[model samples]
Target: MDEHPEPGHDPAVGALDPRAELSEFLRTRRARLKPEDVGLRSFGRYRRVPGLRREELAQLAGVSAAYYTRLEQGNGRHVSAEVLDAIARALRLSDAEHAHLTHLAKPKQHKKKPAVRTQQVSGPLRTLLDTMDGVPASIVGRRSDILAWNRMAAAVFGNWAELPAQEQNWVRLVFLRPEYRDLFADWERKANDVVCQLRLDAGSHPHDPQLSALVGELSVKSEDFRRLWATRDVTVKCNGVQRLHHPLVGELDLRVESFHLADDHEQMLLTSHAEPGSPSAEALRLLASWGTDATTAGAGTPPTRTA
Candidate 1:
């Protein structure tokens, strides 16, 4: 064998284990949720497990105990579609969560390695991506490539665009590279965001070789990443606050939102505010105007220098 099976080092800043991922997701989803959350209840004052017991859930899903256990253990292969549907309903899975379940239940079928969904932008999605005048937005596929970006978005995350096509994963930069720590005002919050997003991807695409490899690489690299990855939290990425530590203009509190095009696949819109004539917003405007990519269609220009 060559000196190293995979030459380049991933530093393992943060990584996820699919088996553990599936187990945690199932356990937590089963816990924390009150019976009232799903219209189930127990009479006596005694309950051994939190949330619904494993057997109770199996009953609700119309599955056998051993089967559901295997599913939660991430060892169940070739699960039936009907059982999956039952589990989805019993778990009270959201649309995104449901899609993720199916991905796990079914083995991935692809000839060449799939490109993590960087392509396949829908018409309405393209239109929405184009119209965002202020926020810097970009659509990231399952592998987290910066596929398409709006003008302001490009500026805010300029460094990502400047990177070679292959090196644009946000998680890679955050944990493996020192620059990631400097870019966010609240490192914990931003780190949490990264971890949560990665968790979501892990659940949705368990069989993606590249995705698995990327995550495995990160897990071995960074202790901080590993710790956060262990939290096992996932998000739908609908809306959130992002704190930015700009190398040029201090910090800007941004409102970030995500809208999905094809179910779980979506684009993120990152916008900063300047009160009509406020200094920060002014800075934002100046940032976009300074070195904006005017020719790029949907993404017009950055509110600031693309860093």
Candidate 2:
């Protein structure tokens, strides 16, 4: 027998139990719906259940009440794609939420042992980042690790290079770093979006210990994170506007875009841009100038005299 077990053989990995996740997801989704929301009649009789009853959901989804109950109890076996789709429709899941449901319901079968998670930045990708002089850009890994960044990104989001590798997480910076928290004009909304994104990631990668640990730590430390996580929201990153309060340059309203790497689905390239001739564009120009001056000053400074 091999003395050392595989990486994901730990108790925590086993404890993740995707069946339980599926059950919880279904329950939460069902709880959020009301009778009228789904075109069902609600009598004046006081109901004990918070949301739609199991029978009601079953009827709506065109499934047997017993089967739906078993599914909700985590006893569902060989559930069909048709059934899953019906349930998703019954729950009125958004695209992101529906995807999360599919992930939890039918996890990928690993024919071989899972490879170790890595965040390697390709040479070509690094070269591409260097070419983006004015646009703020960063490459983020599966767990929101800041893999690499351009100079403009460093200027806008603070230099991730100065922080320890383990501290390069987006979730950690959002909740723990005061400067990062204050940077967003819509802090609460942004925080909720981030948590939702993390939840979606968790559903897809249930056995990822690093992700689990990050969630556990944040739950213990941040009340806001805990509250938002309980909502079981899921959202895919998309183009949006980010209103920032830059320390040196004042206000900046930049358009944010997230692109998934074609070679690595787990990696994302995020970039921010401002409309040409706008105040935000001018602020970006000023920021670039300041960064250039700082670089020049540092290069010209004399080396410290060491003992």
Candidate 3:
């Protein structure tokens, strides 16, 4: 709403950072590969294009020249399953990269409302989360839906069961409510991680309507979300340390271990306590006491954590 603005931003602030990042990444990745890598030949001619010429790649992938060009140009929105597989093969992509490529090329499904997806952890995973008693562990969905957790996790994350269902989303908590800033000791770092993981999820599960809706909501509600979403940095989030300021524990320094679910589009998250005999550990001990037997009866809570 102001006439004066920062560099690369208009009065409206139209262009986003994510798009630039995505385009650059694609260009850089493609540029590194040669014809022999994908089972093609250069014919000993000095190539006009830096990478596999756009047309050559399209031919190898069994796609139209126009379509591949559109995709590389970042103009195309939706791509079919067949084309995705073909491109994956042509690019000589690894398993992880192939999965990521599919996520990017596909379009996110449209949903009326961002209802949470049900992806419960197995008995083993639940037991594992319980076994690591000192850790603050939680299973989440593509849109940061807090699914299930251990006692410390429950305490560290403000007792999810006591909160409203719609308020369970991490993005919702971070942007919609001011409480999150106080919850994390290093709020800015946590905020970046949240958005980056969300961006990766967006790339991986393009058909997830729930995720799309949450992004739409976040982009509308928070300018920070809008700016970060524009970055387009896709990465598989696994391990990280978090400094948490919890309601009961005060503060905690914890280490995180994230395991991907087998073909379920979910993840098993375990945030283990880093220090023993420290204030954080004592707080975790208190949190465990809070979830002692007969305190609150509960069953499994399942949500996909595609990190």
Candidate 4:
């Protein structure tokens, strides 16, 4: 008998469960559709299940019912791209959803774990953060780890230098930290977006141990994280607005922008700023002044973690 398990078989306890992910994605997508929504006439008969039947969906997508069933059952080893695309079209998946479907269907090639858990920020990137004196900015690694941050970023967001390196994860802060939860005006919306972004990241880097651990940790600790994760939503972080209740600066609105570093695609530069001459901008100025004073006062002093 072959010693190795099947291609999509669940490996060790902490490894990525690709088959389970595929199964969940297909099932959730299937459950969200109705007969009428896809132009199929409902005969006013009582339906035993929600959404379109598997056979019905298979017919619409021009695939064999048995094949579609296997796909949903997590046996879709080496599933063709053409078939995935056809099914995506049938389901009317959005651009993000379509990309996510592709990711779920095709797992990344297995690789050895890296010795270093975190990627380092480049010197030029560090200089850029320093140059942007007023704007709050930080460099984030692929796994949502805060690689580095400027004084303004440390002032606006919590102090990254104070947190233990492993604990400086954006997703962890949002879900696990009470102060962060209270900082966002639209906490629910922010939470959903962060979880969705992490889902997208997981799809892209399935074999990443650090990513898996973070997901496992959040899943175990937060019911809200687990529920949001199950929805299988995917979003590429680009631009957004953050309404923050800063402890020292009062309420301020900041525009959040994320830029993928050309030198290193796996890392991104994230910044938040307010419109010039706006009240929020003035608040940011005050924040800058306070940050400067705080830095001078604490010069040569070690950073302390904020509660």
TM-score of each: 0.67, 0.88, 0.61, 0.87
Of the candidates numbered 3 and 4, which has the greater lDDT value? 4
List candidate 3 stretches off by more than 4 Å: 1-69, 75-102, 106-117, 263-265, 290-307
Report clash pairs, candidate 2: none
Per-prediction backbone clash count = 23, 0, 6, 0
Ten residues in sequence with the least summed lDDT for candidate 1: 1-10
**Candidate 2 structure lDDT:** 0.81
Tens-place lDDT per residue, model 2, 1-307, is 1223112223333335567668878898999899989998876468788789999999999999999999988888888889999999999999899999888888777887467577799999999998999999999887678899999998788877778999998889998788777789988878887788888888888777787777766766677776777677888865799999876667999999999999898889999999999999998877787774322222244223222
lDDT at 294 for candidate 2?
Answer: 28
Off by over 4 Å in 1: 1-21, 31-52, 60-62, 75-82, 108-135, 148-151, 161-164, 259-279, 292-307
**Range of the 10 consecutive residues with the lowest summed lDDT in candidate 4:** 1-10
Ranking by TM-score: 2, 4, 1, 3
Top model by TM-score, which number?
Answer: 2
TM-score of 2: 0.88
- Per-candidate local distance difference test: 0.65, 0.81, 0.64, 0.79
Ranking by lDDT: 2, 4, 1, 3
Q: Candidate 4: where is the Cα deviation over 4 Å?
A: 1-12, 43-45, 111-118, 292-307
